[model samples]
Target: MKTNVYGDFACYYDLLGWSRFSKICAQRLKNFVRFRGKGDETILDLACGTGELEYRLRKTKLRFVGVDMSRRMLKQARGKNKGVKFIHGDMTSVRLKRRFNIVVSFFDSVNHLGSIAALCKMFKTARIHLREGGFFIFDMLSPEGLAGWELVEIRRKPGYTLIINGFYFPERTLAEITIEGFVNVSSGDSSGKTTYKHFLQKIYERSYPLDKVAESLTKAGFGNISVSSFDPDEPIENASRWFFVVS
Candidate 1:
């Protein structure tokens, strides 16, 4: 069984300490919208995990739609933000009839597509549901960033422990991850104790050159393209994770 791919893992992803990072990215997104969005209030969160980003931005006067492939993840996200609409679908192929003012895929989620064609599909999907002059925002891992994936990491979060082993294949620009961990779950047996359940899974991510991504956006008919570090103010050459903005 693929223990960490989805199912139970999706239910406990919030405990894996992703909220802090999501909050940072949400703030970045907020800034981007304020300075560049041109009065667009509709948001599309691609692969929105646990809806944490949406919850973080709840104080804002924006309508949100979240799409994720994991049913359990979408369930968790929906539970967290009842007003936000969430759909179960793949990032590469999901389509929403309504166009959004801003479409965002953060946390280097684009790398998970594992191939240029899959990434193209996601970009086209974003293009399809994007309003004219709307901004498309996403982050990706560079080849240099993928090069750093050759290690074993251990993380102790508030409610879980995560162990991950990473392998990078230069020829394919693929990073293979083997994740194993234990998530603390509440037990209603009146013992006032928690149980840690084990999980394991594998994931593959691919790295692409910025030129390739820019070419795809060009082919998608996007204009005013900009690529920078996760911090929009910084340059991309030295940054591991790069963010793209297309208008």
Candidate 2:
């Protein structure tokens, strides 16, 4: 079982622009599905952190089921979203018995798998849950894109402060992100006294060559695979994340 890698971050996952990004991704996905998927179909969302995507698409008639490894993230997701089923499990190996018309893992969640073998397992899991002719869509960190994330940055706001340090190892095609932050916690005693707790989260991600990923997808029983950079306006050579569409 995976540990609570998103323990503290789950509390603030949407404090940044991530929620906004989810809206954009949801809209784009809706457009993609309009062309590639039947209008009324089931969707399985792997690594469905905080259920932001489902919340954004709540108006749609499509049904959704979400799975994630983090209990804390699921807690928030369940609390905020209704009529969508959420399960706690690893994306690489969980089985739901039920199949879906579309399976998606967004926000570079696949990068956290850390190796090609794990990615292959994830691809298989997606295939297992997808109905015949269904689609599997995922995003991954691109080595060329990860190259620009090597830096240190800090953000301070009322009641909290966050610092992010990022490093990319060319030799290993890996990226490491360290996020440390402190949020003020308040409680009422005989007299009200405020306290604070500090949190530190270190995340490691690995990227493979496109060819290697495509080959793995092929072995996982997917055909008609397509890869594109995440941003339509940006050149593929400069984007840090790429999307893989398979059927």
Candidate 3:
């Protein structure tokens, strides 16, 4: 999820700026399957935020379902997509009644795992939710990327402003994001606007080494595990992000 909508964060999730490229990402995933001469229809979007990818993929022939830990995020997603299905639960431990051809967690959702054990557990869940030879795809932050992350950025729009601060804790190999935001909530005309709402939220993320992640997936019984740089055509290199594909 781009922004967790639990607690008071939901009030500003949509207000916080986010880049949109769900259609492109969805096409890449489908092309990946087609390149391998495989059929990918049903999909489960782990940590699907606000149903962006789901909305995009729904245009295709694929079936879509989403799961997340934040109910408020799911609520907003439901508001946008009336008939789509969404489950509110922990991604690492949630149980579903059915399986899917492709299980994907995009936008570095795997980084949200507090520990390698949690990541392995989520991988196990993905494996169990898939049929024979089904695909499990996800992305995560590279250590080099984390090391190079800028500490602060300020974003301003017409009705909202967001300030983001981040730091890495070497002791725990964890990254923290602290955000403070201001949103104009005044009623009536823009000229008469006077009310301003302020909110704050903190988020923490962690990532493991490539070998550890691979070992964990292997132990989880995933086969044909391979990770590549942001560009799937090339090898795993110095890219800021990585994409993992396994069956």
Candidate 4:
């Protein structure tokens, strides 16, 4: 599975104004774990782009391992976190040698699974790598939520200028985004440019209803399955930006 979502944006990911929200989300997960008295448990951060959540865990003195497909993202993560381990791997297929007490994928990372089959594979893999009574927590976009958003094109700049456009198909519960960008360079009174275009397809995934997610968890052998908004305690609702916490 190729990931155009992070391929070019990996470097500017943190600069996109998500750090504060990322920290809040990570802390919410931490609070959930602490409330359950699951302290000092091994944690896995799947699709941990730039290891932002891992960094949050690090501050709490918890052991964490982060996995992402983008080497550039991992590189940035490594620069900030010398203690937490980072791996270059896909979320759906990578296998860790040991099971974890808690597995987390944030920021709609599970949405990147791209298909129902892939999403099921991820649930199965997480179940396999999770200890008995362990938890698997992640997020996905609500179909309605995707439809409410506008598909707009925008440009970002540095040495590079990125153009992003998006299309949302409600019937299929899928969104296709196309990104085209240029990298500019100047040396010795000379200038040059390189352009790249990438396409990414993300399913709205609302078909797998919250109950179905809980059912999948039960099928995967996770006991006491729980589904809630990102708030952790709130009721699951269509308005929620994230559906998480399965254990």
lDDT per residue, candidate 3, 1-247, as tens digits?
Answer: 2433455666556556341545556777778767753453788888876677776666566777899888777876787776789998788898897898889998767888888888899998899899787889888887766654448988888888888899887666678888888888888685875887888887777877888989999988997987789765645677677888899
Q: List the residue pairs that clash in candidate 4.
A: none
Which regions of candidate 4 fall more than 4 Å away from where they truly are?
1-5, 153-163, 179-207, 231-235
* C-alpha lDDT (0 to 100) for residue 88 of candidate 4: 89
Total clashes for model 1: 0
- Per-candidate TM-scores read 0.90, 0.91, 0.89, 0.80
**Cand. 1 TM to true fold:** 0.90
Model 4 worst lDDT run, 10 consecutive residues: 198-207
Off by over 4 Å in 3: 1-5, 19-24, 33-40, 231-235
lDDT, each prediction: 0.82, 0.85, 0.77, 0.69
Q: lDDT for model 4, on a 0 to 1 scale?
A: 0.69
Rank list by lDDT: 2, 1, 3, 4
Evaluate model 1: give its lDDT. Answer: 0.82
lDDT of 2 by residue, 36-135 (tens): 7667879999999999999988888778899999898898899889768999999999999999999999887888887789989999999999998899
Q: Residue 151's C-alpha lDDT in candidate 2?
A: 82
